[model samples]
Target chain A: MSELLHRRTVVKELLKKRGDMVVIGGLGAPAWDITAAGDHDNNFPLWGAMGAAAMIGLGLALAQPKRRVLVVTGDGEMLMALGALATIAVQKPKNLSIVVLDNEHYGETGMQRTHTGYGVDMAGMAKAAGFARTMNITAQKDVLRLRPLIDGMRGPLFAQVKIDAEKLPLVLPPREASYIKNRMRISILGPEAALHQ
Target chain B: MTTVSKAAKPAARAAARRPRVAAPRPAPAAPKPVMPAGTSHWAEQVHPMLVEAGIRQVGLVPDAGHSRLIQLCEADKSMRIVRLTTEEEGVALLAGAWLGGEKGVLLMQSSGVGNCINMLSLPVACSMPLLILVTMRGDHGEFNAAQVPMGDSTQAVLEAVGVLVKRADIAADVPEMVSSGLRLAFNTFRPVAILIGQRVSGAKDFRKLTQPAGDINE
Candidate 1:
């Protein structure tokens, strides 16, 4: 398996163990691949939807303290709403987990260079902003190493996964966008039974 | 004769002593007007308005015009007032608040309205509820030239974004407008703008109130 798919597979397996409110961002085909495998419910677009998912997750976690909120984000999109991390840190929702897919490019935006290309430490930033737990995984083996850490985390957590940009799969054009948007709305608002239909 | 003179002198002295003055009568005590203590304070008037509207989260952009309202929100524990670096940041913050299940309001000035035009697209596209409290800046004899362009177009821009805009030019209109805007925001699950005219916000002097320095920070 390619490095991108392998890392996604490991992350997906880890996420399946935890039952939480998960919001997936439009990173690349990996996010779509994971969602296709029925790993998460809500899949939000990341154009203007970047910083909002985490904030919404923070709110949901605060309102429903018994449940956890996990956000699957991309490096480019995360930078757009970086200040929100500081706000989240101050709020310190223990049930929040932010997983950043750092391929070092805006793969959705035609593979443009993002701040991550300038050697920005996305996980370190989250940690400095006050996330109690943080990790950076560069290999599929290290991705597997996160199972224990993800299981043991009690508060806000951040994880950055570095994968080969060229290895990440490209989703088929316009159809994928519509499918993700429709599926996300269904995930957020519709019954789980209706999702399969 | 000497005995008779002593009795007469004593009685005369008692009679001439200015009728025993009665402690000068305390100058009629100025009839201290029956003004209710704490009623004149703005916090008393504004805090209840926020509570009654159920406004728990407020995203603020600093403005001299909104100083009083901001102060009121800051003093209130029930209301979480977040000060943003820019007006658009405040709009984005409110959008997050809406998605998170908390109702939010943006507090800014007319000039800041210009800064928020681009960011308004997020709410419009997402179909989220936003309640914005705007202090009017440019029109109605504004002294500042910088505020003119945005102040003139505030209503038009808001209307273009599908936001229902209400103007409170008079003091009597403020409370009802705020309450109505809050209701509409929650009911419609879309943003609403309440514009407080310059005369209303500018007429009041907040500095004279002797507010505690650490009230807002806390």
Candidate 2:
């Protein structure tokens, strides 16, 4: 199976289990998968999301305080604003989970090597920057290992998932109409109420 | 004999009188004061200037040259010093801070400039303002060859990206230049660069505070 497919499956399952989570990605595979997932009640865009994913999650977390916020990030997207991790750490949001898909390259941009190739320790770096929990998962088996840790996570968590670089078939349509509908649904129903669906 | 006595008495009386005392001179007006000796870490002065200029967020990548400014920012609550893993990350943080209605500055060495070239697009694309305080590393008598290339390229690269660059050769120029750069950055909503010359921060031992505390606890 393709890495992208694995990622999409994992994300779908995670979202199915834990609803109302914010899945943010740049304009590429992750976004495509999110767009394929179709709209939840919330009308927010699932693809081509920019640097504000974690930040928006931060705002939501701060506003609700009791709700959980999951930010699905890409390696390229996360590199654009890595300092957001430090800011999140400082805030110490108890219900925030940041999952970075570390393909080691900007898959959207012709698969160029990012800093991850230079032995940049993203997990260690996050921990040193004050994240409460940091982990790295390379295989599908390890994804299950993270389930328990992510389940009982009390504070901000940073999980770097390493995946093989292989293209996957487009799972969702490009129009993003369904994602927009989900965003709208979530807005009207509220994060909590929307998650119950 | 009486006239002689009278003259002698008059002379005696005149001599007995004390000569008019010179009016006690008021202590000479204190000389105009001067800036105290050894009170001139450019970083120390720049820290307060940044605070006064409303730059509350400072993102730093540990560089020996920026030690003083980093320590100063760390000690200040009004200014939060976020230590970044890379110079580019620092730049991004500053950009985010700008978006959130807060002003930010990045302090790093010149070599780190290489790490920041690609990330520089964030400000240019978003129309967000950024203020970077870069320490010169390679040019003036630098022992590290790795720093020379970026040091040479720093100004041109930043200028190429539409960022206005200013050089502060002396310690005193830092405050005014930082203040002016910040104003211009906000007014134009563009990134600005203030490059600190090697001599300004290079020679100083900034690990310890120059001023001694009156009380240890305080």
Which regions of candidate 1 are displaced past 4 Å? A1-7, A24-34, A37-47, A145-154, A167-197, B1-46, B87-96, B139-144, B203-218
Q: By lDDT, who's the top model here?
A: 2
Q: In model 1, state the lDDT of residue B105.
A: 76
Chain A TM-score per candidate? 0.73, 0.78
Extract clashing residue pairs from model 1: none
Instruction: Looking at model 2 chain B, report the run of 10 residues with the lowest lDDT sum.
Output: B202-211
List-wise, what DockQ does each model earn? 0.09, 0.04
The regions of model 2 sitting more than 4 angstroms off are: A1-27, A31-70, A75-96, A102-130, A134-153, A160-197, B1-39, B202-218
lDDT digits (tens) for residues B1-218 of candidate 2: 44557659888888778568865788995332233477766677778778887777777777877888888888898876666656776665564344334567888888788777766766665555788888888755566666678888889988997788998876667777888888887777678898887766553333334456543222
lDDT against the true structure, per candidate, is 0.65, 0.66
lDDT of 2 by residue, A1-197 (tens): 43432666655655655454544444466666565666443313334335545654544444345556566767777776667777778878787777777778877668899898677877887899888888887767677766556566576888888766666776554354333433443554555543332
Q: How far off is residue A136 in model 1, in Å?
A: 3.0
Classified by CAPRI criteria, candidate 1 counts as incorrect
